[model samples]
Structure formats: C-alpha cells, structure tokens
Target chain A: MNDSAIDQKPQTNSIISGAQLLIHLLEEQGVTHVAGIPGGANLPMYDALTSSSIKHVLARHEQGAGFIAQGMARVSGEAHVCFASSGPGATNLVTAVADAKMDSIPLIAITGQVSQTMIGTDAFQEIDTFGLMLPITKHNWLVRSAEELLEVIPHAFEVALSGRPGPVSIDIPKDVQNELINFRPKSIDSTDVKAPCSALDENDIREMLAIIKNAHKPILMIGGGIIYSDACDDLKVFAETLDIPAVQTFMGLGVLSNEHPLSLGMLGMHGAPFTNLVLEECDLVVGLGVRFDDRATGKVSDFCPRAKFVHVDIDRSEIDKVISSMYSIHADVGDVLRAANNSLQHVTRPLWRQRIEKLKESHPLRLDGDDDLFRPYGAIKTIASMVDDSANITTDVGQHQMWVAQAYPFTRPRQWISSGGLGTMGFGLPTAIGMALAQPDITTLCFSGDGSFMMNIQELATLAEENLNVKVIILNNNHLGLVRQQQTLFYKKNLSAVKFQQGVDFAMAAKSMGVNGMNLGQVDNPHKQLTKALREPGPWVIDIPISETEMVFPMVAPGGSNRDMIHGEEQ
Target chain B: MSNENQSLLKLIVNNHPGVLSHICGLFARRSYNLEGVMIRPIAGSSSHKSCVWLLVNEVEKLPQLIRQTEKLIDVITVEQHDMKESIFEKTEQFFI
Candidate 1:
C-alpha cells in the first residue's frame, strides 16, 4: 500500500504523476475513508486509494457518496471526504453539495476531470467542475498542474473545515494525479484572521456589564453559532456564573443541558410556551451566535418587544438583518463568551430567574386538554429520554422539526442537526445518512415528518445500499402540519391539499427499500419495538402515526409579539 | 378573505402546462405588481391555485386585471377577495 515510490520530487530523477500527490495529500490530511466510484478518468486516483490505508465505500451513485461524506461530517463534526469522476459524476454530487452548502456541513468533494490535453476539446467525461461548483461551495479550484495539486488538495480540506464549515471542491485533471511530487506536511499559518482582543471592547464590555449588573430580568438566547464557534463551555460557564436563563434556537437545541434550571427550551413558532412568555417579559436579551430568522422571531416587530437586545455573532451581516439590537458585537462566539466570562461580575438576575420559573410553572410544553397521547410532544419526550446525551440527531423541517427542537432535552452542544437556513424538505434523511456514516460507532437518529419524509424518501434506498446503521422516527401526521397549522390560524378554515387521503405504510416502504421498518401506535407497546429497532443490525424506521389534526401549539402569530401566542381556539 | 374592499384573487387552475408562466406574464405584461403570492398543494384536492393579493392605487383597474388573468387556458376561476384592510391583518400574522 506504500506509494512512497511515487514521492520522488527531483526533476531529473523521474516525472511522477500528479495523482500520486493527491493520494499522499489525502493521507496526510488524516483521511481514512473515501466514498466514490472510479471511472476511466479517475482510474489513477482510484488505484492510489485502493493501495492506500484509506478505506473506500463504493456508493450506489455519486450523490450517495456525497451524502455519505455529509453523514460523516454530521457525526464526527469534522470534514468528510468524497470523490467522483468528471461530467455526470461531478454533476451528480451537486444536490448533496448544495445540501451541504445550505446546512453548512464541512465536506471535501474531489472530482476527476479529463486529461489536460482533452479538457477543452470536450473529451468523454470532461467537465468544468470548478465552474459548476463555484456557486455552491465555499471555495473551488481546478488543479492546473501537478505542482498545484499539492497546494489545492490540503487547502481544500482546510477551507472546508474552517470558518462556519461548508463544502469545498478540488477538481483534478487525470494527468495531474499521475504526476509525482515530494510531499511535506506543514501547519497552516493564518495571521490574516486576527483574533478579537476581547469578547467586547472596553466600552461595550462596560455597557454590557452595566446592563447585566443593573437589570433585574435578563435572558440569553443561544444559537448554532455557539456550536460553530466551539463556545459551548464558555457559554455554559457564563450562564451558570450569571444565573441567566439561556434559551436555545432550534439549531442550538443541545447547546445547554436540558436539565439545567436556567436552560429555557427552544423559543419560536414551536418553542416552549414558557420560553416565549419569558422572552416577551425579559428586560434584557443577550443573543449569542444566533441569527434571528423569521421562524425564531414569529413577527419581527413583535419579537421580544419588551426586551433590550444585545446581539453577538461572528458574522456581522446577521446582527441587524432581522431585529434591531440596542448593542451589538461582531466576534467569534467562543471568543466573546470567554471574554464575557472573564469580565462578568458577581451579578445574578434572580428576578428574571423567578419570572422564568413562574412562566415555566404557568405554561409548560403540553398537548391541548386531557387528550390521549396521540400527540407528537409525548413521543418526542420519550425519544429524548431514550437517546443519550451525545446522540447525533437530525430532523426534517416542518411542525415536527420545531417540536423536536422544543421538546428534546439535549445535553451536549452540536448533538442535533436539522435544516436551518433554507428549511429544506429532504435534509433529514440524507443528513442522518451523513451523520451515521461519520459516527459509525455512535447511535444517530433521524426524526422526520411523513410530509418531509416524502421529500427525500428515495435516500432510504441509499441508506440500505450503504448498509448505514441509522434510525429514523417518522412523525406521521398525514398532513403538511406546519402549513396546515398556519392556514388554520389565518386562512379562514380553508385547508387544501394538506390532508392525506390514504394512510402511509412506512414499514412497507422500508422493507421494500431493503431495511427494517416498524409501525408504532399510542395503544401498542412500543418499548420492545423501540429497543429492538435501536439495536437492529442496519437502518431502521419507526413510523409513529400521530393524529392528523395535531397542531404545534404556543404559536406566536405572524408579526405578533412572542408573548402573543394564540392558544387553541376556544370550543 | 371577504366580499368587500376586494384586493386578493384566488385563481384555481388545472395544473396544466404554461399555467405559471401565463399567470406571471399576464401580471408582468399588464404592469401590475403583486403585493404577495402564495402557492401550495390544495388539501385533499388535485389542483393548484396561484393566490395573489394585488396592491394598487387605482381601484378602477382591478376588475379589468382579474378579467385578463381569467382568460388564460389553465385558470378555472378567479375569485377576488376583500384584502384591502386584510393586508396588515395577513402580514401581521406571519412574516411581519
């Protein structure tokens, strides 16, 4: 497996192929696995991979390989690598790459192009992969020469894993991989990225200190930015020190331990009623590394109207894009949180804590009335109870997505992954696939809605094809629950195309896809089914048919204040 | 939606070819700007509606606008809704 014979770099010694450098570079970057299919143009790279220590997973399709890499990233919270030959192979990886772009997963997709001589002449399998992937990736480059391959291969990995992680591509010409080069591993020096001197400048820190010291009621809204910036430890320390209630964004579900008294559950459309109520009353709102998306804000103007906003994020563009902030800081979440922790005084928002406690006591997350447990809320609670603190959970977008965010008690940061920016439909299944592929040893869960499941249900075949051990929990409500809920609240009793005429047999579908599937009902004993499915040999899907009329309650009316949640209509 | 102060129109269609383009081009060709538009799968129904709420300073042109849109082959019906005051009402419920 040693390709050291190809490592000769002396000009007179021998002309080594560039593909040899690619293989060595991947190895140097700690790549232990590559998911791809070899083709004529990529034969050299494939040969190198086969002879190297890195194991190769032959995906059924190019897109499946990309999804596998994405799954790897989701599970390991690290860069996952994939490879494909040019033309159709490169194009096929687009959807998964786009998915990665939307959800900010770090993936390295290496594409093989025709030899340099045939690149411009439209040879078979020739493709302008760099041009094709430009709009979708964080950065993309084509290896023009064998020497360039050395720089681009490792750089692609670095860029993919750095700064709010995203997909990056390196297109290598066939001839380049065949060329030889001497390889040397060196640490990347990034002086250009100057660290912020402190979480806040003296003036802003003083102002924030004054606000926290003087305020009797303050709440902290944490977002995925904390996870992205690796600020969980600092955030936990700061929250505990100040005794501030930290409410998480849907993407920030596991940022704070769910059991913490000051940890308010997710706050938004599907947020805990108590969290929204407390947000409405807080005198000060310190948002950490979270974008105030419309879903989180409900109605932008009415969001936290009574609260004075202090926003901190690495990306300044997100600070005032939705809600105006009385004070703002643009820095890394970890850096800012660390600085804040250092400067934070002996001040506790006791009144705020009391008020939040009272809100929690007043309106907990619950299904309407003494209704039987046909609700997804109880199911979500049960799942959360069963999953460990570090379980990697992905969810499909919809009412169920919000419900998972609100109900699940996450104990570790970045333990949850769901579509956030684009609210993409098919994100759950593929993302779960990626997570499972990434963390082969850990248990990964994909919670999806029947409506959302249909969006990318085809990936179940890919799941089976890859023999990935991931579990899926389908919240089958037989409707586009979120849209249905919105229409119910505003569309004057007009519910169209939102109902399912016939029941969905997910177990049948799973079996057909060559995987294990189980259907669970409220009346049926699910403990055995749950344990068996969780311990199953391969991918498992649990179909839980929740009531079709079920609605995610504690909803803040559009453009209404967070406190203005319209409870179920009076009978 | 109401009968008075109409500003919104729900145009049902057979989900046929060129329907979306025809409706959009009709609006563009007529120089009419839409306030908002929402299209979703009709519940329990096998049809799609391009529900549009138009904002205009000239109320007299509303009827002609609807008439023109209804002439499309795919459009089954055009129902104008009372959306003048409902603009803020609908917006206040979600995106605002």
Candidate 2:
C-alpha cells in the first residue's frame, strides 16, 4: 500500500482475525510503536502485536502508558495509540484521558472488555469502559462485532486528530477481538470531515488586520493550538515582522524563543509581573491559537480591560467563549498569521516598546539576592543555565510548576510539557519517561515538588527498568507549598493537612526502587551537582531542599482579577 | 443553571452513532444537567442526518456550551430558541 493512495479501495480482505485487522490498520497508519499493558481481556490484541511488525512497549501502569502515548503525540503531532484492559486497567486510564482532553492532545485509547455475552452480567474484569470514558473522551464507541472494527478503528483516528484535537476511545469486547471476519476494505470516506486549515472570509481578515495595523500597543498571545497546528515558526515571523511583542500561556512557552526581543514569556495568574502589566497597558491583543483561560487571563472581565481582542482559533467555540473578540478569524492560526504578515503593512510602535522596556526593568521575576536557601527560582535558574536550550522539560502541578514556567527559558514548541488544564499532580516523572522514549537524542528533565512527586512515585521502578535518560529534579520543601501559601494568605495563616510530618528521604526512596539518587539538599553549590545529574545518563533523582515559606509570587488571589495581583508592596 | 431559565437548543447533525454521546458528555463534564432531549432522523437526505432538541437552562455558561456543541464533528448547525419559539413548548401543548 503506497502512502499516497491510502484512500484506494482494497482489492481484497488484507486481514484475518479482528485483532489481526486492528494491527493491520495500525501498520497502515504508520504507527511505529504503541504503549500499553497486557491483561486477560486484551490478550488477543497483544498476541496479534507479538506476530506483527508494530513494536509494543509494555508500560508498568495504564496511566503511564497513556502519558507515554501523550509524549509521542505532543512531540510529533501524530495521533498515537495506547491500550488497556477492562476494570482496573480501564479505570486507571481516566486521569490521562482527562489530561489529554484538557490539553487538546491527539490520542487513541483502545481498551478490552468482557465477552459480548457477559458484557452486562458482571463477569470477571467486566466494567462499563465506554460509559466511564464518555465524559473524558472527545468520542467513544463500544464495538459489538469484529465486522464493526474495520469502520470504528479508522473513524477513531479521524476524530482524535481532527478540529480541536483530543482523545478518542474504542472499547472492544474480548469475543469480538477473537471473532474471525471476512471483509473487503470498503472505501468509506473518513467521516464528513472538515479540512484542518479552513478558508477564512477575506473581509474578516481585512477587518482584523486593519485593527492590528492601527493599534499603538498590539500584543500577540500564543497558546498550545499554535504548536498543534505547527505554527510556531510562522507565529514568530509574524510577530517579528509586525514588531508585536508576544506573550504566551504555559502551553505556548516555545512558540517564540524566550531570547526573541519581542517575547514576553508567560501571562496569567502565575505569569510574569512585567508581562501582566504590559497586557494591562496594551490597546489591542492579537490572540493566535490561544483560549483565554482564566489561569491565563486572571479575572475574565478585568483581564486586559482596555484592549480589544482579535482572536484566531481553529475551533469556532473558543472564539468568544471567554473574552468577546472585537475582531475574530476562524481558520488555522498558521494560515491566518502567514496571510496577515503578507497582506498587512508593517508599522513601528516605538512608544509601545519604551513602555514595555520600563515595565520589564521595574518588575522582573522577583528573587531575594541575599537569601542562600535552595529557593525554587535559584535552583531552576541554575538548571536552565546549565542545560542546553534544546533540553525538554516536563513538570508536575504545584508551586514548582509555576516557578518552572517563570524561571526556565524555553525556546521551542512541545519543549515544555505539563498537565496544563487538568493540573494533574504526579505527571512529571512518567511523562518525562515517555518524552525520553519518544526522543532519546535529547535530555528530558522532570521538575517536580515533594507533594506532586509522591503522587506517581511508583513509576520510579518503571524509570529504572527502562534506564531512560530522564533527570528527575525534585524540590523537597517537606510541605505542600502551594496549598500552604494559599492557607497563609487567604486563611489567616491557618495551615492544615499541608505538612510532611515524617520526612521521607527521597534519595533513599529512589534507591529502594533500584534507581540511583543524588541529594543536593545540604550541598553548598547545587549547580555543579545538577550538572553531573544531567550528563550521568539513565534515570537519576536529584532531591533539593526548598523552603515552604517561599511562595510563587505575582499571584492573582483566588477570585481576583489579573490586575489585582498580590505583589511586592502588598507582600 | 436556574429553574426559570429554560433554553430550547436545536442542532442539525450527521446521523453518526457516537455524536449524541459527544454532545451530552461535554455538558455532563461541566456538571450542566440537560432538562430534556429529543432527536429525530431526517428522512430521504443524501447524507443521513438528524435534528436534535435539548432543553437546558439559559445561564452564562450556555453560550459556551452552545459553541462547544456546534463544534462537534457531526454537528451541521445549531440554533437557540427562546420560550416563545421553543419546540418543547409546542410539544407540551401537544401532550396537553
């Protein structure tokens, strides 16, 4: 089968058993690898995989399998596959499915089920996998027969990778997998699908470009969608050509290089103080492939109160779902931005640059220079300076996540991976493993906090087994710092359920899991030790003691607008 | 969602098996309850499609839901009807 003629009607049944057909389809899709675990229910597919050319990675846990597939998808922009069995295997996949939905990553999750006869009889390992996945998945199907596999499997891929990309699940009963079916490849067109970059109305684009051209202070806000559409380079060119300073959401970190003169790093609650202030002063914001998430926009109404929004998103729903876009374009962001750069005339905004320069000088990411304790900012800065700009960073959710976004200078798309929207804790280690497996040539770093690191600490064994080059950097504050900070600030210093009463030695914990650990807690110079961890190869956990008192600053208090940031004077 | 705020939402979608699940699941995830649902397959269409009517609360999040619902792969078009224009109201009259 030539790659160019995938749509051609197959002359004959190029498949045998249902499981074999599934493998054939995967091969046809050019799937290099699949990450999953084998169980009693899905043994048929696993058996087929054994005889097939497709490489199967046996993950320690179903959740880990999901994230590994996520790593592959996030990096390559390809719809990757993961497998799980019924009951527990299916249940464990929920978190990752939700995470994919929140981040809009393209993933196809195939789970096994009880035999068709015992589907509702409460048989062994039987669970409503389809029902459980419905909410988290973009779409799902329970294949009743082997004959349906031919249609459902290909349709799943189309749904997962199309429009605003997300996860799609297909639950196949055990008997269905084993059932032999004779079928010819019917040229069923890939679901009434819309093209990726749809044509935009010329008048709409003209109106948007006019607003952008007239604005004195125009800012470009980029998001994960830009990366999904492979528009980072185009976005950078448009920003540079028009002299528009660009700010990004955490997911949008690498859309423009951090060193780019116009790049203002991240914006929102945990965003840079200077960037937030710049947004406040700007007259217009050109949002490309970005949703105005509350985390990025502070209080929805008060966020950039003076600026008129010109939003460009592939999904029509995101256009005015949050902030009302005075001017909006419905098309792929890369296409729109490329056209905008070509069609619109360039204008210099010298006054806007001066204001931004002053803002950056006055309110840089704050760190007390004299404090010698292992603050997150200092440690992150040291790692950033030590590692090459090409290194990929994954993180778990907490204060550490915010600090990583604030401190690390990421310069490429898909280089920054974290559980952004879902904010799933314990995402760092396993996700890092998946990322390393996807691209072994580049060093992958996992930035985690003590609290978040403990969520999926079981994956340390998996890391050791694979011996992948993933450096686990943990900020051991001996407390849930983010929760404690909120308690102290908003709850009148009433801290509860935030302390790690019996301190678990992370180094010893990692060693017990058969992985080497290095403690930078008591060290005078941590950067040199970290340098060794980066180059030492394989998985090494570097645990550094940080202060629970050091809160991630420039925080917009809960229910507060971005403008109402709890900053220097208030602190 | 408020008790007095009933919104009659209508959508035209391809008659795909999982399309209903996608729309309903979206609302379920947001914890928004649907008051009622009615779907009727369009007859004699070149591409088999259906018209669906959902009764929900007209809240601030309704617009977002509408947008999301309209974005589903199977959905062709979506329209909103106030109390007077509601098909649910007409159906209620039919039952009465």
Candidate 3:
C-alpha cells in the first residue's frame, strides 16, 4: 500500500488489532522514526508498522536501538521511541535505558512480553519487563488490554517528557497485541497532553537575589538542565549582567560558548586547575539545573567549602541528594533563571574577577603536543576546526572522551552529546547515528577510543545502510587508556588486562561493514588524508593511532577534594 | 509500640497493580527503613484510590524521603504523623 491509500483508509471508530492501535497512537504522538529489530515477541508491532508512515531503522542490537532513540531525544529535546522483544532483547536495552535515566534524556522503550496467561509460566521469550524497567524509568506500564494502550501511550510520553525528563517503558503482552477492539480514535494533540509546570514561588526568586547581592566571590554552576530547559540565553545574560564567571558540569559543556570570557570551562574531577581553584574560592555557589554529581563535586563536604550553595532544579529530590543547599527552588531551572534575571542587579566584583584571571594565568590546563595532529588534544582541536559550530560531537567513555571534552570548542547548546552520568563506552556511535538521522544537514562526529569503539563496532553496518553524514574517528591506542592510566598512577604499574594483545584493524573492519575506511597510520601525510575523509563523508571510519602512555590529566584522586588535584607532570 | 524514634506516614495513592511496588521499591532502593505497612481501600470512597500507612524510622531523612515518594506517578499525597497516631499501633495486638 502507498501513502495515499493508507491515508484514505478509515482510521477512526473502526475495529483494529492492539498492535495497529499502538501504531496509530504513536503516529498521533508525532513520532516519525523508531529504531529496533523485530523478534518473536515484538514482530506483531513491526508487522503493523509496515502499514504506517513511521520509518523503522533496524539496529544490529537492542542496545544500539535504545541509544539511537537516546541520540534523537538528547539532540531534539523531545521523547523518542525504541522497540524491543522480550527476555534478552529487553535485557540488552537495560544499559541504554539506565544511561538515559542517569542523563535525564526523554526516551520511550516499548517491549513485547509473552501472552498474559503465560507471564509466570517461564514461556519462551518471557521476562518481567515491567519490573526490570521500574527502577530505571520515570514511570512504566504493563498493558493488560488493548484498551489500556489509549491511556498508557499518551501517559508514557507525558511522564517521559514532564518534570526532570527521563526514560519510560511499556510492556505489551502478545495476547493484548492480538486482541481486537473497536477504537474510536480521538485526535490527541501531543502538546495538550503535556503536564503544566507548577507556579514558581516569588519569594524564592527574592531570596536568590538577596543572596547574590551579599556575596563577594560568586560563581554560577550550570548543568544539562540549562540546555534541557532552553535557559542558555537567560543564563548568558544573567552571568554577563552580574559579571560572574560560570562553571559547567560535564553535561553542561555547551550551554555557554567556550570563548565566553565568563565561561570557566568544566568543573570538578577532570576540570582545569583554574576552574577548580576559582570554585574553591567562591563565597557563594549558585547551582542551576545541576544535580551536583560526585564526578562534578569531588568530596561533597570539601567542595566549595566556603560557598553558601543555592540549588535550582525541576526535581526536588536532587536538591539535597549529594550536597545540602542553603536554599532550594523546586521548579523549572529556566523559570527560576528567568525570574532571577529580571530582578538581579548589575553588579561586578572586579577584585574577584582579577583573582580568577590570575589563577587562569598561573594554573592553566596544559595542552602538550596540541600543535601535532597525531596527538590527542591536537586531533580533537583539528577535528573541531574542520566542522563548524553547527556540527554535533559525541564520544565514548574513556580518555578519548575526556580529550574531546577538554579540547572541543563548543559554541552552542546541545552541540556536545556524550554519556556523562553513566559513562557507557558504546554510546558514541549509535548516538551519533541518531543525531545524524534527526538533523541530516549538519555533520555528526563520533570520537571513540579503540577499546570503546570495539564495544559497538557492529553499528557500522547500520550507519552504512542509513548513509548518514557521520564521521567516526577512532583514536586507536590499543588499550583501555583510562584504566591503564589508573593502573600506572595508583596500582604500582602492574598493567594487567587493560591492553589488547592483538588489535583488530578498524579500517579494514569498517570496509567489511560497507563503510568507507581510512587509516592515518598507513598514509604518509595523515593531515591531508584526514582532511579529505572528513570533507567527503556519508559514513567513514578514520583510524588515527595515538600512544597508550597519554593520560587525561589534572585528575582528582577518587574521594579527594577538587582543590588538591594530581597534575599530569607530577606523575 | 509508639516511640519517639519512629514516625508514621499516611499516603493516599492510586489503587493499582504496581502502585504498592512503586512505593516499596522507593524505600528499598533508597535504603529508608520501613518498620510496618498497612494498606486498604478507603471506605465509601472511589474504588480506584487507597490509603497506605507506613511506620518508619530515620527522622532525619524523613522529609527528603517524603519528597521522593510524592514524585511517584501513582502517589497522590504524603502526610507525616506522630507514632502515637499510627494505625499499626492499634493492630499490634492481632499480630502479637
């Protein structure tokens, strides 16, 4: 059937199977694409999808599908859906869903369960998906009947998108999918179903302003919430108007342009010496849309010990989860920032700014060998120079990821995408595919280490088939660099199990998967080859080799205060 | 059974298959101590709603835990009451 023929078919007040109804409901929610692979359980939903307009991208694994959905949702700032079968398929999606939950990305995972009657009978492809997803999701549902899809589908989107946006899951039994029912299709507007934000307290804004007025050395600590709530513009204005420097958490990297004078790069564990030092001296810490994660707040008690912290987040539970706040505002961070911006005075502590400038000059982030393209920092900077600010950058969890975070000059919100809270190694490739799928006009760069790349290397086939404008640059070090670094620094140099004895040739592997591959190691002029590969790209994997001895520096020992950072040269 | 160290929490929540699990799961995952729990449908009220009364310790984390519980989709309202007002106190004789 063609598009017009499907459009002509009667959609409302007609008898349809539960699976068909689910497709129609998803269509109503404005979902355009879904990523998943059909299996024994979820085949019915896939079968129904053939008649609908939704395009399904078949992922090599359920984990890839979940991360693909995450990529779309993380970039678009809306809830995107992924599907999976029961048992192993559902289990495979756990990591991605948990990653989404940790990062507060809005995602929906729908899984097919065994027939309702055979739930506890140990039937084929059976698992308690509802129970598995309960702890990870914002909310979840196990559909008992076809009729419940009407309420569950919309509520799933609502729960996933509302408040502190996070992943949600739905488990549909096979019997429910096959169950026939008369569905009166109502035009459910996606906007209408969104829950309204609670009214912000005026007094909270008043108190925030009063605190800002008294503090001599104040710093604005921002996070992903600023990007999610679309408060980046407000934050910029507020920080500039007050002449206060702002420090970003890992997830909040692109909220302020890296070149912004008030922008003090990322703070906490892997933060620059100046950024962490400035945070240490601050008399007041205004945390906006930040959860104060341990990675960003090493030794919670000792972090900003002199600062009176004020936290603003949409979720109240996060206010005192790690560090107690002097004042907590439970509302959208955008709402709080907008309110504070209105009443906040134009004040500047020139003395404090001078102090911060002095620290920046004295203890700067050392970028050794940054002029050489083969080096980590140099490779990242060269890549950033190749792509415009519009391009999206993603990285797998390792030293390569930290290198990208440190060197990539991000200018706009939502430009930097990575697994911050969960630090999943295989997140880079699939997420870049999703980003490319959502916004095909711009380039999507996936910077992965050899260890991290091998984890989801199978997704290269999906990338080749989709023909997305994604460039995968594997910084092949032939070892788990971060783990090796730790072993070298802390564990008496007994480097065991961190190195791959025999490395797989990534360039040849990419070619076998039908993607264009280039190995910089084999080329005489790697810079020229890299330039050519990045310029002409549908899907290309460029293997760039770096030494394993390179480590992400300015590190804080686990459980140590951020102020006492272990420098690279010290090791 | 009423003691200074304990507090009673009264929660009005949606009576559903997963609502109880959602509440109990929060307690278990967050490591909040739950001494006792009593739940039943409200008399002469809508069948879809139920009242759950819980006896819990750790008064310092009570306020934070209450906020977390309220964030659950099924939980409607959570109210803190003194141990003297505990519903479990009156029914202690039956269990004993």
Candidate 4:
C-alpha cells in the first residue's frame, strides 16, 4: 500500500461508539455530503451525524438519496456516500445501486441493519441487506462487530473506487453501531486506493497499432471508461493523429465534442442513420474503454460486420463477452493510448473521410420541428442553446432522454449524465439535484418526459428544500412515449397500458411542492418565459406540452441490425 | 467420476460469512452451469482463507467464467484443473 493516508491524524487509544467511528472515518475520507433518510434502525448513525461537519440532505425516498449521491459521484468522478435504513430503505435503494453498478460509478451505500441478535430471526425491518446488495454491488459486507467497521469502511471505499470503479455496500447492524470499542487510530490511506493497472504487453500494443495502420477504414468506438480514466484529451489526440472517425456509445458521449470534424456522434439503436451506416462499412473498429453494449451494437453478429475489432479495456471479463476481438488488451485505455501516441504518426484517410461525408449527406439525423420549441427535438435544442458548455445535462430514460442524446451539443467529458445501461426512468430530478449540489455555480438541466417525471415526482420536495439551480423541463406527452412508439412500430400499434388515463397538472404539482413552476402552453411568449426561467437561479419546473404522437426516428428495432434502420416519415 | 465434459476450478477465497454467497451468486446470475461445489477452511492457515472447488460442465464458457470469477474482490486466486485430478473424484464415495 502507498504510505499516503487521508489528510488527518486520528486520536490515539480513544473509546468511541461504532456510529461515531463511522462518522469520523467518513470525515477522514473527505465525504462532505450524505443523502439519506433516518429510520428505526439507522437512528444511531443519524444521531452521530448531528455532531459531525458533514451536511445531510434528507431525501423524500431512499431511491432519491441513492441517485443524489450518484449525481455527485458522476460529476466529481469520486466515490461519494449515501445512507439508508434496513428493509424497505435498502430495497428502495436497489435500483439506484444497480444503476451505479451498470454505469460503473463510484458510490458507497451504507445501510443500517437490525440488531445482530435479531438477524435471520424475522425481526421487524430486518431483511438480508448483504444478500440483497451482493449481486448488484461490486462488493458488500455485513459488519460482524463494532471493531470490524474500521476495516470494512475504508475497504469499501477501496473496492468502490479502485480499478473499474463501482458501487459497494456495507451493512451495519444497529447493535454493532451502538457497540463501544477501544479505537486505536490507525491512518487510513485511501489516497492511493486506485489499483495500479497491470503493465501493458508491448506486443499487444504493436498488434493493435498494426491493425489500425493497415485497415482501409478504421473507426474509434469510445465509451464511459474514457471518462472514468480521464482520457478525453488522450483519445482526442489519438483519434486526430490517426484521422479515425469516432462514434460514441451513450455512456461515451461528450468524449469528443459533437462539433468535431471526425465525430460521428452516438452509434447503435437510437443513433443517427449515418453513424450506424458508417459502422457497417468500417474495416477496423478500435474500441477503447467500451463494452460493446447490446444497445450500442444492436445485433452483435451483424454490428461492424466488415470490421476486425480491437478492444482495450481495464476489465478482462468485458473482453469476448459481447463481441470477440482480433486484438484484446486488458489494460487501462488511457495508458494504452499514451503509449500508442509515442509511436503514432500523423496519417490521413482521404478516401474513407470522403465516404463518411457522402453517407452523412445522404442519411443524416432528422430533427423535425427543431425550430419549434414545442417539439421534442426543438425543446432539447433550445435547452442546449440556453446553456454554455459549463452546464451539466441529465435525463430520465424515455423519449426525452433519447431526444437530448440525439440533439444536445455535449462538448466536454462528464457533461452528459444519464442512465445508460440500466435506462432507469425517474433518474433526472434527483441526479440533477446532485449535480447542482456538487457544482452550485453552473446550471443543471434535467429533460424528463411526463411518464418518467412522475416516477420520482416526490423528489421535487427534496429539490425544494435544497433550492438548487436545477431546471426540470418536462416534455409533457401524457404517455410512455418510447413504449408507445415501439408498440406502433413492432407491436402492430397494439398499445397496451402505455397511455395515462388521468392527466397530471405538473406545474401545479411543482408549486404544491414549494418550487417554482411554469407552463409554456399557458404563456403567450414561450421564448421569453423560457429564457427567464433558465437564467434565474433556484429550482424550477418548466412544463412544455408536446404532441404524444411524435417518435424518436432513425431507430433500429430491438434485436435488428444497425444497418437495417427504421426511419420515420420525412419532415 | 471423471468425465470429458467436466472441468474442475480451484478457488482460494477469504473465509467469511458471505464470501460463499458472492461466489455462488455469480454462477447463478450469469446462468453458468455449475455441477457441484465443495468448500472448507484451509487447514492451519493463519490468514483465514478457504479452498473451494467448483465442478462445471461449461467448457466453452470456462474462460469467460474464470475471468468473471477473478473479478470478485474476496477471491484470492483461481486455478484450472482437469477432472482427472479433481477432489470430487476422490470424495465420490461419500455421496454414493
């Protein structure tokens, strides 16, 4: 272990309760904020919080707390913390924890369990939190005793933030939290917690370079790993030097600015028609820090059919798990790119670039009614235009999320934060609240649809309490638009239980929650109203009513090849 | 007891309450076919480690399975062995 420790010296040979010790250790780990709710089991930890410097944001629900912490972690690129009580609190946190696991965000979820004696005895609020969290988290622990907290807490941080960062849970029984221990203050060093990546084999790097050099048409497929590894600059340089057109996975968006000449934007599923077309004809696919997710690679057998894949990721399991690669390097992508840059020569592929330009001209992403703010694409574009590159964008999963992904001009890494792998609805408001909390200076835009906004609508109360600058723009369509779209396309228009029977007055709902609310439909000058709403500070819900019939076009039907795209009627 | 279709995997893991669950959960969730499992604390070892042997019939996915298993934090090492050298072969009489 590196001798460096958290920047605090502990008091020697002091007596402290397990709860107090946990709080102190968290302080040492530099956790400034924790999002959670107090319940019967975790009251001791909550009591300990009163005497600590850390600020607690009491969320309306445990799921909100979990995503709130995720928002902070995703923005800061650090292991952040959340807390919940046993049973329902832990269960409620399941989706957010699983979301972190899928997205590889560094988060530490600490749940309070029932007393040690009551474990497995059918005690009230007693469920097997460790077992519940085991499969979803990277690692989980059930603290056996008060003394074990010292080891478990720091180790949880290490496991969560180290190689291939992910969420981890530590379940502390109420009795253990109340147990008194003779604490010997040992310096817990988490500064060097990140595991040193294994040394890259020179032969593998040489082989990857050779494949890229020899291929007639090479494309760079980047993903979330690039952002996690902080390799955006290195990736940009590598792609530019090789003159390779880069296509981002949903998680990989913002690694290259949408305006970059070589940028092909997002690929697969709801990707642009031309972007997916480019992938079909490419001879070499050099995937850096990507898993070739099913959404990004529609039909795995047909994706990049003409390309020889070269996958470089930190995790060995991701290799050959989805798509087999001709050259696979199980090392950090940033390190690999840095090494490749040393020997890389500036090369140009005029013929391949010309071919890509031709495809782009013929089959581009259709943004119908983008000039009208009432349309989905138009709403997203207008939001993007209002904020500078410093603004952070988040979304709840649905038609609105896809619209933002398709239309938003994401220019920097960590700028676009959404639920990618899990595709969880109701992810926007709380996560954007987190973004606002982490970076209070910049505006955080959450583009949510009516169906997704209602899932975590209760979190508006939490947002009201924080009073942060998070503007939630609900593209009100009164239905699960994506589900309805699929029903129309693939299910023979057999719409089942997708449309909402009752209409919700979202503006009134926000106002009832003690936050600012606005309805574009009621305003005569929507442009003026929107500009004023976005420019002002504090939380606001801007409800823009859009037609329910609109669909996200250039979509590849589920299980279909990316090449066989289903385009909507021309604008 | 040994067969051409069976493969033996030896895992050295931290001996703890939920470590076994973590290992077993991975197998179940990934849909990997696990034929049998045996686990015991490493005798006379001070480090509190255990030895686990998994008998599986997934020859094609063994490499990927091993890679996934190695990713678990509690697992110390994974070694592949042939069914001919399996501990299940030696302990067959107990089950019979």
Best by DockQ: 4
What is residue A246's positional error in candidate 2, in angstroms? 1.5
- Listed in order, the DockQ scores are 0.01, 0.57, 0.55, 0.71
Candidate 4, B-chain TM: 0.94
- Clash count of each predicted structure: 27, 0, 0, 0
Best by lDDT: 4
TM-score of chain A taken by itself, candidate 1? 0.86
Model 2 stretches astray by more than 4 angstroms: A1-15, A195-198, A369-373, A522-527, A568-571, B1-10, B14-19, B30-35, B44-48, B55-63, B79-96
lDDT of 4 by residue, A371-415 (tens): 889998888888788878899999999998999999999999999
By lDDT rank, best first, the candidates go: 4, 3, 2, 1
* lDDT (C-alpha) at residue A494 in model 3: 93
Cα RMSD over interface residues, candidate 3: 2.6
Per-residue CA lDDT of model 2 for A1-571, tens digit only, reads: 2112122223375546677777777777788889898898988888778766676777778998888888878877889999999999999988988999999988899999989999889999888898898888877888988888877887888889887899999999888888777757656586456564457677876888788888888999989889988888888778877899999998899888888899998999988889999999999999988888889987788888889999999888888988898888888887787776677556677889999999999988676422342777778887777788878999999998988888788878889998999999878887887788789888898999999998888888878887888888998888988999999889999999999898878889999998889789665666677788788778889998877888888898876888777864432
Native-to-model Cα distance after best TM-score fit, residue A173 in candidate 4, in Å:
0.1
TM-score per prediction, in order, is: 0.75, 0.92, 0.97, 0.97
Question: Please, what is the whole-model Cα lDDT of each candidate in the order they appear?
Answer: 0.74, 0.83, 0.89, 0.91
Q: List runs of model 1 lying over 4 Å from the truth.
A: A1-15, A37-43, A61-63, A114-128, A178-207, A368-374, A461-468, A493-504, A521-525, A557-561, A569-571, B1-96
